[model samples]
Target: MKKRINNHQRSTIKKVMNYIRRYWGYLGMSIVLAAVTVALTLYLPVLTGRAVDLILEKGVVDFAGILAILKKMAVIILLTAAAQWIMNACNNKITYNIIRDIRKEAFEKIERLPLKYIDGHSCGEIVSRVIADVDQFADGLLMGFTQFFTGIVTILGTLIFMLTISVKITVAVVVITPVSLLVASFIAKKTFSMFKLQSETRGEQTAFIEEMIGNQKVVQAFSHEDEALEKFDEINGRLQKCSLRAIFFSSITNPATRFVNSLVYAVVGVVGAFTAIAGGISVGQLSALLSYANQYTKPFNEISGVVTELQNALACAARVFELMEEPSEVPDAPDAVNLEEADGHVALEHVSFSYVPEQKLIEDFNLSVKPGQRVAIVGPTGCGKTTLINLLMRFYDTNSGTIRVSGVPVNDMTRKSLRNNYGMVLQETWLRSGTIRDNIVMGKPDATDEEVIAAAKASHAHSFIKRLPHGYDTVMAEDGGNLSQGQKQLLCITRVMLCLPPMLILDEATSSIDTRTEIKIQEAFAKMMKGRTSFIVAHRLSTIQEADIILVMKDGHIIEQGRHEELLAKKGFYANLYESQFVNTSSQA
Candidate 1:
């Protein structure tokens, strides 16, 4: 376990260095400034020593010499302060730039991931990595950038200046410093795993919060308030424990390092006093040695603290890197062609797939959809209806066999190009925080105002949209929260109407709309799908009564198929389903 953790820390450090390497120019400038700052600042002790010697002369006091030394001290102080300021500016720039690049790469990797990966993980977990974890990492990295470089230069500069004054004292200081380092290193090693657990638990907690927030209505509908609160308390208590444990381990580093620093200071003072008494060095020289001793040891305290914080940085960075390194969706085939203006002849040849190996969902699924064909698929929930849409859109590749569009294998076409050939509206509605016109033009960004209004009218969305304060120009709240469910569905349908791709997939497209509005939208959809190959997945048998072919699916296969009248005449599984739904509706009325 220890070996694995050490390796992980080493790997995180290596990857972090690679990211910083991209800004070598800024980093190099920061280092040079830090060196200059330290070098000039190191000479201050020497100036103080000279001033002390001049003022303590047995003869008449040489005010002239003291004044000159003071002037030099002022000049060096100004230069050192100036260099330190510029160095901090450079550090800030480098830290923020690296942070931006990391977030950009993480988000881009997420976009390139397969649907299976997203389906297998919680949205809150991914969001936490991108947001909370990145923020935590940024704090640690910025702290390092500001302190680590200057701390190293200070220690080295102070050591060299002290060596020039007295090696005997320098050796004592150096030897005692390792004790502090040993203490800090030991504590730092223990914090990494604790902090890692804290980060993971925080992500899980975020996932739960997001899940509950998104489904609060459902939770209330089911009277699950107490259960949710209990679950949340459990997660919150775990996070509190993790946080306390990590903080406890890291918090002791400062005092431990300070104690060692104080020991080093005491040794330097006692040794320098003895040396001065023996006439090995003058009083002024001894003063400079004491100052050097303080300077040299102070950084050990700071650097050790930085190291503790650095452990936290590495823990957060490992999570971010893990996300970036997830295998991206299979790259486009080397010879993949663009699917342009497809004739919409889709065929599935023995396609097999499952969300998990142990529980296969769709196996040996076969279908043939002709150009301009209107096929309606109806099935019980959890029967792999949406899974078929996922394959058709190439959101997930088939486990075996093939799915082809226009006689061309889907795998042989660039995913973007393949997806462009179809327009889809699912049961769920998604709208960005944008104006009504903006959402309508998502699939076809260059659509004109007149065309957008025409599509809205056809989708039965125009009348309500016009009633809004700004008509089509009105901005929507997040996810169109400002709109009614029926209104949101109407807007989504407007998107498909505006694009009118050669092929269409409507999965419970009008489920949220009023029955009266649904009838009008169905009329509009009928006109839109007139010459386009269309696949409608619906539970409303009445809506699909006019479909050219109605497929009854059970357990991932089409058990029965025919026109509505033909299926009813046969009195098979489809007939029984239709009869039951009709009976339920009549009884409810």
Candidate 2:
């Protein structure tokens, strides 16, 4: 029984309590307003009945007294309304702030999360957690508790007033409330699971849409639009079914509540007529009792509706809190320390790692680079070259080895402190839609015009940039579509150079450029690498000639390591790779 209760009180109630505890002042105000509103509403009919009784008995009602009573009742209602509105407005403001906080925190948490966590969850799934689930919960939080309390308080106050007026009529009306409540509860319980199922299905559909939009280029390239559409339709069909089920169950509440309310209304009319005939109740009393009975029944119906809605809201809240309670992707260790000085001497010692548990991608990987040494790493496809760079950058923690900078383990360093110390140029250059200067100065926002120009010149990108329609201020189109592949790469290189970090990693940075641009970029690269501890993941052998050391990787291990000239003479893996390249070049010639 305890376990069952705990299950019912999971994420939703926990999350609701957190919000309620934080904004209890606003909630308290709203509740007080609600009580006043109900009290005023309950007394209005009694005052109206008194006015009627006075008029009938005296043949002339006390005008001042009746006006005073009406005026007092109106004042109560207006004050109650104004207070409730103010409290609800305050509640809305708090809810907006809470939603913003949740979304912002969720995004920040997602950023710190390990690559495995991101890769395991689809973009749609994570988006659903952040967007849809949070939205539903936030909506529920804003109105669910306030409206529910109002309904309950109103129902109870109405019942008390009815019982005071006459026991028989009160009994008749009260009997229907529980029967309505039980039926509504049964329907709500039955429908709660369906709401959850519908939400999950919607999330799946959302994820698919996100995936498709993010990879629209791939979809068009593969001509899989029809297949994608078919799959989407299939998921949408399932979503429709879940939606229908939820709606079907929810529909039962309103009609059932109304049916029970109609029965109470009939009973009240019959009992009230007999009471008036026997002198047990006045005509005014009977009319007042009838009005109160209607008022009471209205709340019962509203309460029933609110109960079902609360169940659905709870389901959404549960999903949202479940995500919030998930374990952090890369939580800080107990002994973590902030990095102070970043001299950029990156070292990897016995660094074994793998994305998949079954396959060890880097078994006992060991490497050391002196400060300001330019090293090149070359390998066949899937040979852990990118993995090694990823490990060096501390994007993924090594499975069994230690990666350090200046004798300090990277795991101990704060991510912000560590990442801010280095610059990178990736193979696929991503340029946000912004001016050329905007993209260039992104690396160092405080950079002056002269500094931006100097960095661009050092990257060999200044000449082409100057020729654009708007020169340095030319707006780059979406994804840098306005620029050539080589131009985009040059722009990215310029951005990296602007940072002027002591450490740099160029991962297949020049591979997309033409031979002419590659030569030009190599010159700029040579200039940038001087006195910087740089790691170059190169495909072309010509690029590695000037490196102080070359590491040839195969599978997941380093098979050859030496200076460029020294490796050519060994007739090993590096020698074979060089000879194979030579043969391919000769055959092309």
Candidate with maximal lDDT: 1
Q: Give a tens-digit lDDT track for model 2, residues 97-128.
A: 77887788788777767777777888898889
User: Model 1 over residues 1-589: C-alpha lDDT tens digits?
Assistant: 9999999999999999999999999999999998998899889989999878886647767899989998999999999889989998998898889999999999999999888889999999999999999888988998898889989999999988988888888888878777887898899899999999999999999999999998999999999999999999999999999999999989899889888888888898899999999999988998898888788877888888888788888899999999999999999999999988899899999999988889888888889989999999998888888888899999999999999999999999999998899999999999999999999999999999999999999998999999999999999998998999889999999999998899999999999998888889889999999999999999988889999888888887888888999999999998889988998789999
List runs of model 1 lying over 4 Å from the truth.
57-60, 587-589
| Per-model TM-score on C-alpha atoms | 0.98, 0.89
What lDDT score belongs to each candidate, Candidate 1 first? Answer: 0.91, 0.82
CA deviation > 4 Å runs, candidate 2: 1-9, 51-77, 329-344, 431-438, 463-488, 575-582, 585-589
Tell me the deviation in Å of residue 184 in model 1: 1.3
